[model samples]
Target chain A: MTTVARADGSAPELLDRLAADRATGALSTRAGIFYLSAGHVVHVESPHSPDLGELLTRSGAVPPAGWWEAVERAGTRHRVGRHLVDSGRLTAGALELCQLGALFDAAYCALAHGGTVLRFRPGVTHWLGAVRPVPVATVLHESWRRRELLHRIWPDPAVDTAPLTRTGGTGPVALPPRRARTLALVDGVRTAAQIASASAHRTFHTLVELRRLAADGLVAPAPPPPAHPATGAGGAAWDEPDTALLRRLLDALEAL
Target chain B: MPGIDESLLETMRLPGARGALVADWISGLALGAVGEAPGGDAEATAAETAEFARLAVESGTLAPATPAVPATPGTGSPPPPPGSEPPVQDLILTTADAYHLLRFVSTPFDSTVFLYLWLDRTDGNLALARIRLAETADRLVLG
Candidate 1:
């Protein structure tokens, strides 16, 4: 048998290994956190993407009061999803759809993070519980596909990570209403994820819209963040290398 | 409300259904699937079908026209209410050997999920499959 060089090496490799062993636990990556149950990815959370509750309340799936109540009553037992459904706040299918959406949305960013520090804590399931267990393969494969799609739509990754501003040109830009609305939210301070949360929209969808905006010159990076964010002027305070923050300078242009 | 697996099973009960799947149109991930996929790979099929659905749903030329702001009673149907059902409810594709039906499900969120059913052409009743798929979509549970 050939040596398994890649097993548990990268996020994808580790997930594959876990699936093979039917392992259950949480995989903590710099990009995001994934909770697996018996080899199935029950939930995934990314710092750059809205969580299930955000998606649920923002989408008007369940009222905010009801959502908090469910969490208070059932979150500790990992039955928040079930609680919401049983309480008739929403149907089981609706919760599943929303949960899947949130999972895939965050999973894409989580994997896109692609950092080296990947850790898995065995037997630690998410308090949200396994609303619907997605196969690990499906999660990884979709993340790759989304990365490719975003690249193809607009090869620039800056629009995804950088703060954005609208183009000053007065030319009428004919765009679908959805993209137009997302564009209006750009104020040279909010990154795609910030805009997504502020608008209560899916972070991935917001990214797609931003990419499209960049492709059409409707949006542009506000300004390049410092490339080498080292050595503070006041004192030597080493800050955490926030992936999203560091990435803001990846495509930064030379200061004019 | 039938959960995803139960919903798939319900669709499979159709007379000519060869397979069934629930996929997110936006992410192209197969949420739940049962039986053989047209591509022999459920994930692959889900992605391809999602592409097909996006083309139909997002195309400006094919979507229903937005009604003018001012009230005009004697005119075509008003555009679907924002955040309501998608303009196009379902789509059907006929192949040489089988029939494919995609029914969009409305949810509290983006409503990006759809039900895909593959039915044998010879034995499948297109009308029946369409109705059942729509019903299944209405009640298919997720969590």
Candidate 2:
């Protein structure tokens, strides 16, 4: 990664330089605030921070789909924490806790990486931090540990960003501890909705089971639905057979 | 008459009580604490314990298996997910000589703090100590 230092001592200026240069590296300030770039801040920990989307999901205050929609809508216009609170999704106390948590996590990551201040800019600053090479083995081990703790396997990153879906696949999966007899019914052929319809278990339990299965490398990511031909708003597009069929399926699912 | 000090004193009364301290998990700062001083080193232990709590919560390994109740809107985002809450709020470490219990108390002020206790394992009833600690935490008020 290319590193550049700016004489302008301001956070905004540093940020501008980075954006102008299209540079990717850890940025920090003397104040101990720093940002890591991983598809947009894989981690951020500051004394002052917002509730991360991950924190919101874990809190169970917002559904994953709902949170994603909010994020997309908010983009960078609104402070995420403020947006969530304004939307009546969280309380002030909860917001404070979440912000603290995010900041703490980000700080830990920054410290672990041995971050250095590169330059200060007005509103934007860049700092270089030591990059700790994370081994894939470490990730896998942590994943396994998480699996054991949550008692559910969640191998898909999409679950964190997009709506959950089921994809069909054929594979022999080995579950840790002991495999439940109920898991025998999962063949990747059934949608989560379908499984829910057929089973008497709670939705949370079924979802957890699906996540575990996905984590065990037994299930594949679901394919995106085919695009529909452009049609007038409210214009019946039954003219295109595929569009009509997909529409019908979506409608059916919505009804269910 | 002060709540936190009284709580600390009560913790000391427990069988084999070594020391007791209160800490803020957010900033890793100790508010008030008493006991063994661990060779006159309560601050270090309090800071260390706070770090432990923070790490445990962030690691998601020892997080509570159930989700915390969502705070009312305007308070910010909801609590962390199920299995994201730490369980060592009142940690009881069993050693050959003493039992250490750290109990966390979430005040209405939104400060995530806890009381750390050390008791002699030989004389402590792990369960009873936990109950008393919980009660003590409830009565505590931050200065």
Candidate 3:
């Protein structure tokens, strides 16, 4: 398992080498893409982490109207961040901080998982433009650290996506400040990511807190989405499906 | 003005500072780093420090006691502690030859990240380093 995981581990190494060569392009991974400029990682995006636009709006850093205006105006030119900063929708410092946070957060998920197929496209730029280009080495090092952190917390990946339920019947449980904030938002229907979105917290932090809560038995693991009734149990429905079809056909013939 | 990289660079200026890194305690990922890492590996150091920070922040005994639940009628559960300031301000670990300082940075965003500074015990001024770290953590601007 480790070897198979290590196979894709070369993605980061290849990125570092590309950085050494001052290569410019995008490295597409199974989870996300990293856009590099002259070997420096200018931007990264992933399905796991919320995008900068959403993060900013959710945090009240930038209003929805402002974000929309910036996007509508600069999205075509691939300079959304620049537009936000230039238009004073966000301070340059704030934009840099949010941009970097979004980049690293996405990179953590992109590089941590294994079996990722990596492909590079030369001379590509992210739509947000470059707020701050992080060193390739820094991104790799942080991604490795994030993986270790998650493992140390729970050592289980199931908690990452499972719906959360209270462990027991409302028994009093102690929660740290951060966990308490997160617990208020979990309704058993939301996965870690959903809770993060609803709570306006970092997705990575929400996952870590969920893992910790799971380890302490404060939350129960999702009972695998009640597996769809097997064919054997639902076989009768499949056998009888013609009634609705036949009724619809009869109605259509009568109308004709 | 002090973003992640600038904040890290500020920490490296303290006397006897061996290395400094900004790492998220929740995910244990280093946001930015400067100088040389202890044991020559920044990632390992971030993970180790994150473990210590997580344990300290999450300890019920060390956590500040929750205030009494509000008297609002039929509040299904106790209201969480008011105010979002994390209990831990800074943590320091002393070894035979070096001191490790983990200073948590407060932000309005979802995550908690701390600045970790490894100082040479022989040359580091513990008192001065602590004061400076606090200031840097305060001024760090995170989006």
Alpha-carbon RMSD of each model: 6.7, 15.6, 12.6
Model 3: how far residue A63 lies from native, Å: 3.0
Q: What is the interface RMSD of candidate 2, in Å?
A: 12.7
- For candidate 1, the lDDT comes to 0.78
lDDT of 3 by residue, B27-73 (tens): 66666779999889887788789879988888878756453435543
Clash count, one per candidate: 4, 41, 0
What's model 2's lDDT at A219?
39
DockQ of each: 0.40, 0.05, 0.32
Candidate lDDT values, in order: 0.78, 0.48, 0.73
Q: Highest lDDT: which candidate?
A: 1
Record all residue pairs in model 1 with backbone atoms less than 3 Å apart, i.e. clashing: A93-B141, A93-B142, A96-B142, A96-B143
Question: What's model 3's overall lDDT?
Answer: 0.73
Error of 1 at B29 (Å): 1.8
lDDT of 2 by residue, A1-256 (tens): 3444454454434444544555444565553454434212222433222235544564455667767765666645534545555676655434443343344333433332333455422333122121122222222233233334333344333322122333435454333211232355544344443443344222222444556555544433344335565555523322333342354457559979
Q: Mark the regions of model 1 whose C-alpha exceeds 4 Å error after superposition.
A: A1-9, A224-256, B65-85, B141-143
lDDT of 2 by residue, B61-101 (tens): 44433546555443222333343323334566676777767
Q: After superposition, how far is residue A78 of candidate 3 from its true place, in Å?
A: 4.3
- Candidates sorted on lDDT, descending: 1, 3, 2
